[model samples]
Target: MNDLQQQLAAIVGPAHVLTGEAELASYLTDWRGRYRGRALALVKPGSTDEVAAVVRACAAAGVPMVPQGGNTSLCGAATPDQGGRSVLVNLSRLNRIRQIDAANNAITVEAGCLLAQVQEAAAAAGRLFPLALASEGSCQIGGNLSTNAGGVQVLRYGNTRELTLGLEVVLPDGCLWNGLTALRKDNTGYDLKDLFIGAEGTLGIITAAVLKLFPRPRAVVTAWLAVADGAAAIALLGRAQARFDARLTAFELISRQSLDLVLQHIPGSRQPLAAPAPWQVLLELADGGAWADLQADLEDFIGGEMADGRVQDGVLAQNETQARQLWALRENISEAQKIEGLSIKHDISVPVSRIPEFLDLAGTALAAAFPGVRVVAFGHAGDGNLHYNLSKAQRQDNDAFIAATPQANRIVHDLVARLGGSISAEHGIGQLKREELVRYKDPVGLDLMRCIKSSLDPRGLMNPGKIL
Candidate 1:
């Protein structure tokens, strides 16, 4: 073993330090198979102190360090570079729920804890940690915080940024910043936690965090409704917000193309409605009231919409089993898409009102550019973020079209920029969107970001080749 490898092995038992190519293969490649890189070694540290020690050693040796958790990044945020000069610091061994203060409505946990684990812990204490995502079962808290991930429940609960209360990070120089406070209101100075929460491990390595929790809803309802198009869905969203307000937990918009892909690729997947529509909405309502009353109220609302022909058709989940089945249809879109084939994907967000315009323009432009291009659009319309993906219908054509990703991205991202939208909503600017970020990011804002990065990591040793 090399000197640094030996030091890493000593810091966290030899069993935790991985050097074999087979042992490091999975950590090197991203889940989407889009990014594969080489690393000096993959080291798993069991505690925050060990992580700090490893970071100090790497910093002293002038080796780049890449902080990785869960390895489920859609944007390759956790993957290393091709240089093979950096050490991959895997934080999975630091999984631990340090504290659960039910009264304080907060929980402190290590970065390696799976998002699902944190959610379960919150539920056990009669609280809700509402950072719901499709990959929550495998994705870890550190990555979620690093990417500021948004999911179906973002309409009501906001993203990871809002759910986070404090952070414990190991800076580039190996100093530990313990801002792990549970307080909600503290305007003492600049919010340091915010800087690390969405920094994508570029400035430092996050070791642990304190996250906020909400009252567990006693009553919950889920439903699937059919809408004519984006405009109709947005109109329905406005009405639903007017009536249900905070009771509405999620409002997802799915294109017929996207739903068809899911049904065709995902086994046992069935249509939520008897009649098919061009667009569909999967929404949920939750409160601490009686379930029967909440269900009845939603039923009345749906009856009124259907009577007016505003909603084409709909089905309300009868029970928890039905609810899970309905949600499965929405959550499995990405998996189904992967099964179909490779796609040029874009995670963009415009103002809630301009989503229809963005969709109409981008769809028309893409169709004009490449006929028979299949566009799979779906996501949390409640937050104006949409997962827009494109590919040709046939495998041969798609294989060729994959090479035109730059052109497809220009069409979609230009529309996003013109509409004052973000090229990356929930997904971080990993290797995938680094170019797009440069093209669209404001010059002044970009300069400030670079300055901050330099200030925190002068040598650029932290997660090199990501973000800025």
Candidate 2:
């Protein structure tokens, strides 16, 4: 074994150091199964101290370290690059909820804890850890923090970065930064935790965190609304927010093609509206009181929207089961798309007011560029984020379509930029979006990011070939 490999094995026992092809295979491929890489070894560290030691050993030997958590990154953020010189630091063994303070409404947890486990811990204490996602069961909190994940509840609770109170990170040099303070108000210096929150494991390795919690919602109402177009969905959102305000937990927009894919792929999927409109919005509202009256609120708002012809048809959930059924249609989009086959995907975001314009312009531009291409656009519309994807025609095979990704991205991302939107809204700029990020980011922004990365990781050993 090489010097660095020996050191890694010593740091986290030889048994935890996986060099076999089969064991390392899963760590190399991303969630989308798009990019696959090779690594010298996969090192599993079971604690913050162990992580620091492993990182320090790698730094000493000048080996690049790829920090992996849950391996659920859509953008290959948690996957190692093909270079084979680096070692993958798997953090799944560190999963643990260290503490849950009901009084402070906070939870201290290791970075490898699954997001769903954190939610359950909060629920046990009669609080809600609202940073949720479709992959919560497998995605770790560290991955969520790294990507600054935006899920359905982000409209109400905010992204993982906002929900975070503090973090424990292993610096590039192998020194541990104990920033895991549970204090709600820490007016201390640069708020260093914010730097690592969305760094995509490039700046440092996040080992643990202190996450904020909220009072559990006593009532929730989920509704599926059929809208004529993206503009109508935006208008409906505005009208509902005027009445519900903070109670509005989520507002998702699903395109007809996207919904059809769900029905075609997922079992037990049924249409919510009889006459399918061009677009659908999944609206959700939750409150902490028993007298939340979400039904009355939705009925009144839907009544006005229907009268104004903004909404054509709708189905409000009568119970929790019905609510989940509605959500299943929204949550299973990625899975359904996977079943459909390979496609070019974008997680773009614009200002809430300009989403309608973005959708119209991007759709028009893409159609003009690639005729007969199926556009599957859907996602958290309330946050101005959309999972805009384009699938090849049924007759065309995957390879022919895959070759058109660059052209398709140009048509879609250029419009997103023109509309003052982010090329990468929720997904981090992993290996997949590194080139796109360079193209779209302004000079000053890129320079600042470079400065931050150079300052923290002077050796350029942390998660190399990712982000900057």
Candidate 3:
């Protein structure tokens, strides 16, 4: 371990290598505080070459390496293992915006650059990155690509995999694969970029990427609508899509319980509607047209929905400030839930058409087994992903509720499997869902994944015990 640390320090700098327990504490845990790991040392590489060199040193010493960016992974994908035999490769020093090609509607950036920084860079170039996340200001792009993150705007812009055009990776054996092309369509051979985009850093370490951009929206209308239930929310989504088409940028379903939690826990959060319905949706329409006309069209469409009894009540943001405030209610949900209590969280996705059924069945099953279980469900309805979480009702012991996680997971995941849904939606299978992946993934697909992992990382010294 001493010799390996010296070699890594030589590759980067002595000052960048950290071995102190205090210095490594923050990097050892996941964002949710659910996973705590140990490492031999934390190495901060300054460039792609330095990263490759560090990987080569680790490979030679047979030490596993965990590639980490901002340490903001929800599934513990970037955290090292408890064995303390691995080296944590911190990528924050490699942060850089290499180039911006507005003509090609793309931007190339180093892995350590924060998501908000990328969005601001695109906005400076009069374009939109459109990959919005509550953690954008803190989460790094490498982690985003590694997880293939999906946000509310995925309804229009797609996930991180779709927004990405190219990647520069440091292979497990210290080789650099520079496939950073900004071309829109290249039917050259196999789509190599897709493999690493959502592999959760098990295949290789992502150093940089070429990301797609879109024209800035000239007009945006944000609205909060009250619906009957998840079924009504889906119906409203269909109606909105039929009328607004591609202009429907976001459609988020928030249950009344979710909204109430935000209202109670988040200060200054006011209800968007007068009378509380069983469910609500936060929708947005954006386009390259005049702002006034865009708002008018959205208002007209919403008025018709109200007249048809699809929407009970709604509120259109008067301006951008109001729009941002409305978004705050949706974005602060996770934080609010955190303040409320400990909960079993699931980032699952089902077929868009079966979302209502999934919700109904899962809720019923959970309620029957675990009495007084609070189901705090909300997420991107347009993309069929829901952050379904559970907590005990008031006066119940959270530890007791949490002890039933395995049972809870079986109930929820079995129903998801029956309805053709994913156990891990945008979040990848890190240490958190490794066992679940084994049970849910097809045998053939799992075999192929194992073969690829073995071929690339034959030594198994790259992010060990993750995804695989």
Candidate 2 per-residue C-alpha lDDT over 18-107 given as tens digits, one digit per residue, 9 for 90 to 100: 998998888899988899999999999998899999988888888899999999888888778777888999999989999999999899
Give all TM-scores, in the order shown: 0.99, 0.97, 0.98
lDDT of 3 at 232: 90
Which residue pairs in candidate 2 collide? none
What lDDT does the true structure give each of the candidates? 0.95, 0.89, 0.93
lDDT of 3 by residue, 1-468 (tens): 899989988989899999999999999999888999999999999999999999999998889999999887888999998999999999998789999999999999999999999999999999999999989999999999999999889999999999999999999999999999999889999999998999989999999999999999999999999988889999889989999999999999998778888998999999877788788899999999999999999999989989998899999999999999999999999889878877999999998999999989999999999988889999999999999999885745777989999999999999999999999999888998999999999999999999999999998888999988
- What shift in Å separates residue 205 of candidate 3 from its native position after superposition? 0.5
Candidate 3 lDDT score relative to the true structure: 0.93
Candidate with the larger TM-score of 2 and 3: 3
> What RMSD does model 1 have?
0.7
Q: After superposition, how far is residue 339 of candidate 3 from its true place, in Å?
A: 1.8
Off by over 4 Å in 2: 395-398
Writing each residue's lDDT as its tens digit, candidate 1 over 250-276 gives 999999999999899999899888878
Q: Which of the predicted structures, 1 or 3, would earn the higher lDDT when compared with the native?
A: 1
Q: TM-score: which candidate is best?
A: 1
RMSD of 2: 1.3
Candidates 1 and 2: which is better by TM-score?
Answer: 1
